[model samples]
Target: MSEKYATIYKTIGQNIRRYRKEKGFTQETLAEKASISMSYLTKIEAPNCDKSFSLEVLLDISSALDIDVRNLLENIYSQPTI
Candidate 1:
């Protein structure tokens, strides 16, 4: 994948992690709430992994986290390189 997309995914993943922690949820809890496998959530949140997911998944995650999709997509470019 290109560097730009990598950064975007990383940022989204980091944001997910941050919000998940803020909500006091475990990976398993969030995954179940999002209707995704815990392992997939693990991969998406892994900084060294470049995983891609669908918009529906993003929406599901956002809904589960009780946050806007923009929160996950925020600060993509502004974040320092992973």
Candidate 2:
């Protein structure tokens, strides 16, 4: 992926982590709620880990988190390129 895409993924991961904590959910809990594996969630949330996931999974996560999919993507384009 390009740097821009990497930054987007990084931001999405950070936002997911933030929202997950705000909702008082463990990674495992969120993973189970999203019907995804814990390891996959872990990879998505890990810093500097630009794991690419499908939109369906993203939607599943938003549904599980009870938030908008756009929320997870907040500030993605605003991230500075290196």
Q: TM-score of every model?
A: 0.89, 0.91
- Kindly list the per-residue Cα lDDT of model 1 for residues 1-82, writing each as its tens digit: 5665787888889899999999999999999999999999999999865788889999999999999999999898786664
Highest TM-score against the true fold, candidate: 2
- Determine which window of 10 residues in candidate 2 has minimal summed lDDT: 1-10
Clashing pairs in 1: none
- The segments of candidate 1 whose C-alpha lies over 4 angstroms from its true place after superposition are 1-4, 79-82
